[model samples]
Target chain A: MNEHTPTPTEALPGAGNGLPSYLEQSPAVRERFAQLQQRKVILEVRDLQKRYKSLQGETEALRNINFQVHRREFVCVIGPSGCGKSTLIRILAGLEKHTAGDVLLDGQPVTGPGRDRGMVFQGYSLFPWLTVKRNVMFGPLMNGHSRDSAEREARLWLDMVNLGKFADAYPHQLSGGMRQRVAIARALVNEPRILLMDEPFGALDAQTRAKMQRHLLKIWRNLDITVLFITHDLDEAIYLADRILVLKANPGEVQEVIEVPVPRPRSPEQFSTPEFRATKARLEALIHPPEAQGEEEAEGEDALPEKIIRFTNVGDNVE
Target chain B: MNIRILLTYLSRPSRYRGAVFTLGAFLLPVLLWCAVSYVPFIWHPMVKVENPGGVDYFTPGMLVDRSEFQDQMKEMRQAGKPLPVGVRANPIYLPAPHEVARALYTAFTTAPEQRDAPWLHQSLWHSIQVIFWGFVLSSVVGVPLGVLCGTYVTLSRLSEPFVEFFRYLPAPAFGALAVAVLGIYDGPKIAIIFIGTFFQQVLVIANTTRKLDTTILEAARTLGTRGWRLITHVVVPGILPDLYRDQRILLGWAWTYLIVAELIGTSSGITWFITQQARYQHFENVYAAIIIIGVIGFGSDLLFERIGRRLFPWDRTQERKSA
Candidate 1:
């Protein structure tokens, strides 16, 4: 699985043209990458497996899932639908039990949901009854922080998410993107060692989703926390992740881990770069194989059982 | 308010218009009752005797059937005696609107003819206590049980089937047993109300609890919340608004059973006042007592609605639609 081309370290066409080259990392970024490689591993999963049983029979949802996230690393897991990405993130958050595996955070075995790991789901999970400030304060207060301290912490995180002005607003009053931002603030206020996000911006519109991506990247860069993000969008994975963990469907297992060739301080301008396109193409191929593509095309044809039965011929002359 | 706006289908009008419509709701019914009572040609089936001249059985202020009054007047006329005089009026049971309105004020001040009987206010107070205790007790026991049933599938499976079955049986069916066990006093009356509301309350509250978004619970768990704190902080507050609504509806249900419940005991509440006035043929007082019960029930519902708005300011779904 590691047979993919080595990380592109050589200079490309735009190197001497007074334009940033896609195949090269800046000296400072290279130095940071070197430091990050040496940083202690914050989370580790080994030979993880999950099985769901019903009266029909037992089915494997995930198998042999092995990965490690270094401290302060931004790792995105990209896979097709039904690839158990949500299940994997839930297990890491300790909200779900794996059939067999060891999940460790800071070298401590994760037994159940604890303050060490914070989670943000794809859906709007903010408590509707709580104001933005109180929603952020929930984690701290539950872990025994005094109300004053919790409120102080909540205010800081809310301000970080650019939602300090809406601290008193209820969840229903906010837009989808704003709600997700508050959710992120709520998760971060716990000061968790790692953050697990399962398609947190999937429900937003294209424009809002893009904005939230940049917002999250900024937050991740400033904070000293590791992130394991799950998404199906290749562009999103390439845009946000330092490394992308691509998984193959039917009982999901890791296919490869690609080091994002694009450099740090990622911007929307970099989306057209050769490196970003290359990585996205690779993910697309891994998720939708050539052999499966043929079968899917045939199935698509079969799905439309009957020809169109148009009663109106008004557009026939135009066509 | 314009009639066009008021008549618009499925459209909420302005607040002033809404108030006007509510007043109209009360006035429409009262106007129909007044038309039937005061209009001389509008089926006044009886005659109220003003001067009972030459009629052996007719007494002043007595209401006699119109047909019977006519036959007596004809007999008097044929005998050349001064004809009996009367005016069109509704039957004794259907008191005129003015008489009932007067009784509304006079019923409270009038002493009970029987020295041992309680006054109208005392009867009303006693009935209110029965309703309060019965409903409060039901909520205290049922709310927690319902929340538990909704939270855990095992508990729900164990209890909901029986609750569903029991709620179907009329609450008054337990009157005899309650009287035997709790004695012929407020205890039995309260028990009947409890029986009426408890089973229904558990089912309603359980359904409300189930409607609480599961994603919020999952989010709470991820935030290091565990065990009973999940219930107290997350589940309870999450369903409080819906639960409050369920209680309001259940309180109304409790009131529906009050008359039956009061009848089960020694008859010491507003029901007693109604029955006593009815026996004495003071129909105006009976109507007054019934209307007072309606006012109390509707007024309390309105008060609860106002309090609920204040308690859960964040819940805007219950807010009245704007124009």
Candidate 2:
């Protein structure tokens, strides 16, 4: 895994100028590479593990997970249910504690929650008691920003989300999609370096999900900020991410990391493209490996199994 | 005549139908009382015999007071008119509506001979003081403890059983103990109201706090909020609208114990005044005191409902719950 073998599509242009390789670039482009490398690493996860201790027994949620998200890159981690995808995002957000391994942001180990990272949840957890403006300003106020400045910052983000007219509306008064937009503005108002989203669009209708995806992509390009998004939708990952991380469950582990060959500023029509279909097929195959079928055939034959590990969640194992 | 004219004006749907209904409902009980008190008995002629044997009182099938009959006869003789037929008209059990209204007016207007008397205002003020102090104490003690119990599972498990057990034991049962410990003064009265409302407040507030969604708290944490800030910003505000509702209900419960509290120690509250009047068979005064109590309770409830709505404009459930 540490062979440093670059995947075939790793050379795709990311973020700024889409000029070709260093060997082909002029001296000025080569000189710019040094400066790019200076802030290359934004998040580093090494040997990450999480365990839950219950009266019944110990449950290993995630094991030996390792990844690095580079500066200003959009990365998506896609997995089946109970693959510890939520847990990994929570740890990155510093909302949950990991049992072992290290997670660092800008070379500093994450201790607990800090304002450096913003998080968006699938539930769209906006404070129900506050208006849209107040919800957006909550973080800045907590950080001791003056009321006027916080209000100004809140208005700017609300305008960015196209919800400027709803600054005085309570969360319950808004629809689910609109509420999630407010939540996004609330998190972004703090100006965090990285944004962590856990299935942010999973609860939205398909049309709304597509709209939000486009909106997020537009914002991502405009702000040039790093994003670590978690989801179970393969097409969504392919459409939105520069790189996709596939995870397998039952003591969840990283199965593979695939680079999306499609270029940025993605559109909804790209879902039908051959490149998108190819990447999605590869993920589906990895999720449901061929060996799983062989095991099923052996069970039908009533043959002696090589190992016996009875899991209560047999359906989960099959998935 | 004016009331009849006003009623006719209000009875029209285009006019004040609500006013007509309120006035009609208010008069219904008084009309029933008057009919029951005055309509059953009829007047009967009393034949005065010349037998000279104690002027044999010949009253037939009528409840007649002997001295009242003689007084009527004497008044007729002095007027130079023939003695009208003696008849019984009034019953003593239920007072007329006018009599009760007159009693109420006198109670409000006349200064009692006793010093520092508990008239309408004084009696109401006394009860208010006790209820106010008791409710304040209960809120101060119950809210924080309830928040702690709700926030921490260990504290909830440790305290909930005891709270539930004591809440069922009856707050009034502590009346005697309260008098013994705090003496027969304002202390016992306040203690009774506190005991009546405190346990329930704690349990209700804890349940409200516990019902707070964990997702919102996680959202707050990711924003770099922690410690007391988390409690003040997220937990308290999250449960506040619901907690305000709970307090309203608890306040009503507090009112229930006030009469019992006032009865135990000193005769100082409106309930005491009513009970004292009942002992003397002043039914009109007793009824007046009761009406006063009802009006005040209703007025206070309306005020609380208005304030709750204003404080939590963001809470749809609070608005619906109050309505």
Candidate 3:
């Protein structure tokens, strides 16, 4: 892993000084993620589905949720709330059971969780008794690493996430942003082939969330690790994903696949650019599709229907 | 906290020193008692204990010798200047504040051999023995049962009534039952401690189990962790800081039971020693024994706090940093 290098075509020279896109991320950090899509297929989910019985009737959380996460592909699933976006992410992480079909990781059906994958939950699920460093070391230590090796890995990951100074601090001592950073370091310390994040930064403030988004993007580019990120935020999906999967409600299934054509080392300032705005508007309309003139409102939301506002070249909605 | 804000934060800390200041204010009053009672005066020192009608009548004064004044009054002589109205009369009472301090200092520094063996036994070993035995009994029964109450649904349901029932039984009532069944001896003292401490420790273990964070436990099982690993690594650590705090409280509870045990148990303990002294013409010894008991109790609580700090350093840091 240490001997690998990025070719100029894969590098983002737009970053000042014509550096590799991954180098524009945390410098001196090792590339621990698997190679790009060319390496190997690590996880394959076939016809995966999960159903929940509601008071109204049986509600399908997911149906025919099929996707294969190639080695080192950053995939973001963006959808409406009842679209089973989060459930599919949990199933892929082995944190939730699939009612139909099966999940294969590293060529074996995922019977239960293994060290090969790590999950970052939406809420702060940190253990209160552990210091930041010890929390990071939890997975490796539990897997029976020697104390020294665990400490080394813990320190490396904490520094990678810019939390080296907080290793000895308890989770409560940290702000929401800092704690999520620790959670990321903790998840990545085990060097899982795929890191599953379920809206990990959803609780952060807007400014902090933006900072974390960029940090995550850097981490993704540097490590080239496959990420199964689930979020309802369309901008976040457009911002970070190489490809975004959109899901629809009522027997949830992927409705669209939006491939991001932008190069890496992208900045938040680009969000106002013409290309970015068009993509954002398209996603916004899809997630909140507008109703026909006389059609009834979306189920349970009598006030409004799914959004389908049209837009002009300047990115202003025309309808 | 910044140095500039230190004083702002510190003002509140110092305001809470009311307890320390109050204890200091009483020090001189206690010391006065250790002196005036021993010096000769025209009348009894203070608090005359009279056995005149076989039922004792006590008369308190600014300067009275309890036993001698009581003897003189029973013989139809004056005790001293008449005690003021609203003054409480108890033979063990010392009117002078300084005397109590002297008594306290004397009780602590006096050699064990210098005091009669029975007095020493009653003042020290008796209470210590009771508290020790009580803690042993509680741990022996409470912890395992608490674990069962927490981990297993059937055991929890079955044990709930017993735990709740026993927790409400007054310590003094338990002491009376012990006295009736075991008679005055080591058995009654042990029973007193056991009765006082057992229910609390059981609750500690049971509550810790019942409240083990469900999310963490779920995370553990999802990680392929099961059996002891699931219980020890996930469940135990998840509940440890809470358990340690409860353990510290348990140690203090043991000391509290000691005072209750000594007060009622017919065996040798500081409470028993003080009671016996109060009956005799020994007001000084009673005050002295009480001060010693306070010190012992405070010291035991402190010892456990120190032990908790050492064993659970994470909790200490969490407390100090407010994290």
Candidate 4:
């Protein structure tokens, strides 16, 4: 296979290189990388395990998951469906309990959901009854901030998401993309230490999704908060993350954490870069191994057996 | 009205068209009633006696079957006496629209023949109060219990089965018991209304509460909301519009039990007025009172729906459907 298609287990052709080529290409990128490495870890997940017990039996959803998100870093977790990406993010958010693990935020043990961790779900979760501004104010007000101060903070966050004009608009009035922006504002108004997003852009159309990715990256660039985004879209994970935490399915576990070689201050034009293609190829190999691909192809041929009964005279459309 | 617009299936008409249809809905029935009442050949099976000449049993203003009146006239003519005079009329029970319309006004103005009997408005007011207190009390308990039940599985398991079972037992069955325990007064009447609506309110509200998106609650939790704050800030507001609609429907259900409830104790309320007027064979007044009950029920529902739109301007589901 070409250097772009290195197997999951094999090191890249330039593995021995002291520094990734993209870092060497720009002094600003090198400096940013150094600063990122020096930043203290804001979120740490150690030996996280989750088991769901039902009448049928116990099913391990996630096991031995371990990762650390440095302050202000953008980390994306990508995996196939049912790979426990959502479970992982939920555990981090304290929305779901893990059977065994220590999720530490700034070295404080995370228990249940708290303002320290904010979450945005894929589904439009805005309170249908509240205006965009009120939805954003919910957190601060709930946490004992007076209505005036909460409103001020909510407006600031709404403006940050470029939805200042829509503060009075209801969720139903806004498009799907706009609703998610409001949701992000709602989450950010509390100024959480870490933002956990579970496929927050999964529901958007391709154009909207790309636009939101840019919007989110801009916000992340300007804010001091760290992000832990979960997505199955490989391109989305590569486009936004400082580092990509890959997971394999079944009893989901960490596959490999790839340091995105694409330089910081990223842009859409860099999508076709050799570094970007290299990282994407590595992810593809890890997620869809040759063995599985061959098996799927074999199954595709015989998965549909010859029908025993024909209800229509319509011949097979495919030649 | 455009027939093409009216006949379109599963499509909402324009606002003007909808208003016209609504008016027609009301006008059509009243028009049909007028046609039956005024058209002599349509269904006037009886005749009102104008004069009782040579007929010992016939009296002026009395209604006799058309065939019987004819036979009497034939007999009277054969005897060579002045024939009875009559005009086609409907059965007395089926009062004309004009009479009922007159009763709508006069029923309030007409004083009770017996001293100390409550006026029509007073009876209506009492019925309204019974409905109000009954529904209010049911909602006061039902809304919270239902919200809690929907939020917590333990509470749901503890209460839902019993609520489901109790709702199946007809509320009227508790009427005699309520009267026995509370008293033969407004207490039992109110209790009957309470029993009629409370169980259903709890279940319906619980279902509505369940329909609230769980993701919103989860989002609230991550925002540091917990304990009673979750219920007050998240659960309640999240389900308020749906709860408002459920309460409206439950209020209607409470109205359905009003007559049965009033009959349980000492006869009172509009139900009492209706029975009293019926006993005097003032069928027009009875019809007027019944229409008033319907008008009150339907009018209150419209008022509630309007208030709901104001209270939840953010809820566009209703607006979308109507539009």
lDDT (Cα, tens digit) per residue for candidate 3, span B112-204: 443554645446875777777778787788877776677778988888888789889877787778878877777776777777777877777
A33-129 in candidate 1: lDDT tens per residue?
A: 7887898999988889999896879988889988888999999999988888998999998888999989988889898988889999999999989
Scored against the true structure, residue A228 in model 3 reaches a CA lDDT of 86
- Using DockQ as the measure, what is the rank order of every candidate, best first? 4, 1, 2, 3
Q: How does model 3 score by TM-score? A: 0.70
Which of the CAPRI classes, incorrect, acceptable, medium or high, describes model 4?
medium
- Give RMSD (Å) of candidate 2 vs. truth: 11.3
TM-score of only chain B in every candidate structure? 0.91, 0.73, 0.66, 0.92
DockQ scores of all models, one per candidate: 0.43, 0.31, 0.22, 0.50
- Please report the candidate that would top TM-score against the real structure: 4
Error of 4 at B221 (Å): 0.6
For candidate 2, lDDT tens digit of each residue in A106-196?
A: 9899988888899999996999999999999999999999999999999999999999989988897788899989989988989898999
Question: Which runs in model 3 stand beyond 4 Å of their true positions?
Answer: A1-39, A51-64, A80-85, A248-255, A292-319, B1-96, B106-117, B144-162, B165-188, B209-226, B259-266, B281-291, B306-313, B316-323
Q: What is the TM-score of chain A in candidate 4?
A: 0.88
lDDT of 4 at A120: 95
Interface RMS deviation of candidate 3: 3.5
> Among all windows of ten consecutive residues in candidate 4 chain A, which has the lowest summed lDDT?
A16-25
The residue-level lDDT of candidate 4 at A194 comes to 92
User: Which segments of model 1 are wrong by more than 4 Å?
Assistant: A1-35, A297-319, B1-13, B47-88, B320-323
Show model 2 residue runs off by greater than 4 Å.
Answer: A1-39, A288-319, B1-116, B154-165, B319-323
lDDT of 4 by residue, A197-259 (tens): 999999999999999999999999899889999999999998999888888887999887877
